[model samples]
Target: MFFFQGLTMGLAYVAPIGMQNLFVIHSALSHSLRRAIMTAFIVIFFDISLSLSCFYGIGTLLDHVTWLQAVILGVGTLLVLYIAYGMIRDIPAPISLKDQPASLRQTMSKACIVTWMNPQAILDGTMLLGAFRVTLPAAESTPFLTGVLLASGLWFLSLTGFVAAFRHAMTPRILRAINVLCGTVLMLYGLHLGYTFVQFFQI
Candidate 1:
């Protein structure tokens, strides 16, 4: 019961279209199947690590530390906006299996940045997973967390698989359009973060 509860909650938590999802979608639409899967695995690694950290206690630190929150919000907003700008400026070509993909190291670094540097992700994880951890039975904590981690793996793999399945249909025009839309969404999110950062000072 606890595991299912966690699984449902985890799916709901990660289902939103955020930077992580955007990265995965871009990978799926552009890269070869193997590369896309690799990207998803890399993202899953960071996401699970983040979830573990939040469940253990980092969330509490962020929750209480106003200065740390401010710093993260400030930096994250800039980083997100910069990434969005790059995505818009450099739209990818249509999918090609023969195309050389980005290095694994580069993919790992990007995955780490998107998952770790995201202030909204950290706060949300802390508020949801970290806070909920306190309510779990000591023994059930492991199972609950297992379910959450599994959700991350499943969702990313499923998303990658779904996009890869339709890779052939992704024309250059379609890919460019997707890039623009994702970039616009990211820009909006960055602006929202900036607004939140300012509001933090007002509070």
Candidate 2:
């Protein structure tokens, strides 16, 4: 029962079109199949790590430390906006199987940044997963967390696979359009974060 519950919640949590999802989608649409898969795995690693930290205690620390939250929000807002600007400025060209891919180190660094530096993700994970953790029976914690982690893995793999399967049909125009749309969404999210930060001070 706990496993299923956790699985459902996990799916709901990750299904939103957020920074992590946008990065995965861009990687799938732009990179080779193998590279895309590797990127997905890298994202999954950071994502799971963040979730674990949130569930364990990082969220509690953030919740109690107003200054820490402010710093994260301030920095995250700038980082997100900068990334969005880059995505918009450097819209990827059409698929070229012969194109050289980015290095694994760069990809891993980006994955880490998108997952770890997003204040919204941290707060949401803390409020949702961390709060839920306190409600679980000690014995059921393992299975429930297992289910949540499994959902994350399955979702990213499935998302990457689906995008890769249809990648051949994606034209340069279409790719550009998607990139612009994602960047716009990211920009809006960054503004929202800025607003939240300002509101935090007002309170």
Candidate 3:
């Protein structure tokens, strides 16, 4: 039950695809598989820590901050829009690897930097995902965390393998498709975020 529950929720969280998956695929196909895994581990580390932190800390504190919901919604807006822009801008860079060798340490460091420091990940991991756990029974709370961590691991591993297997398929045209998909999702998410913000402020 935990496995399937984790699998379903994990896919829901990651199904749309995102920047982290993009980089992992890019690295695995062109650079070192070791490097992709290295980076993925870092992402998972931060993701787990953040999930736990939000579950324990932010979820509780948020109730007291009357204005926090609005503030968070606004930040989420900028985040999604900015990611949309980045998806458009960086799509071209995926193929031009500079032939740089993937360094395990470098990949790990980069993933950690992005996941831990990025406001978007923090918001999603804690404010959003963690908040979902607040209403669950105590026995099932463990499953929720399990689901999150399992999702992260599965996403990274599959992403790495997919890219490695289909490196040749990811041509420029395919990248264009990926860019369109990523950009569209980011924009839609941005719109949802804005709507959420407006709902909170009622203006």
The candidate maximizing TM-score is 2
TM-score per candidate, in order? 0.94, 0.94, 0.64
**Which scores better on lDDT, 1 or 2?**
2
- Model 2, range 65-136, lDDT digits (tens) per residue? 879989988888888898788778876776888545688998887788789878889988988898889999
Q: Write the per-residue lDDT of candidate 1 for residues 1-203, one digit (tens) a residue.
A: 98988898899988899999998998888788888999999999999999999899997687688799899888888888887887787767656777556788878977887888788899889889977898999999988998999999999999999988997887888888888898898899889989998998999
Tell me the tens digit of each residue's lDDT in model 3 across 23-119: 5654565555565566667776766676677767665565688687677667667765775676566544454434545466666654654454344
On TM-score, the stronger of 2 and 3 is: 2
Give the top-scoring candidate (lDDT): 2
Better TM-score candidate (1, 3) = 1
Q: Considering lDDT, which of the candidate structures 2 and 3 is the better prediction for this target?
A: 2
Pairs in clash, predicted candidate 2: none
- On a 0 to 1 TM-score scale, where does candidate 1 land against the true structure? 0.94
Better of 1 and 2 by TM-score: 2
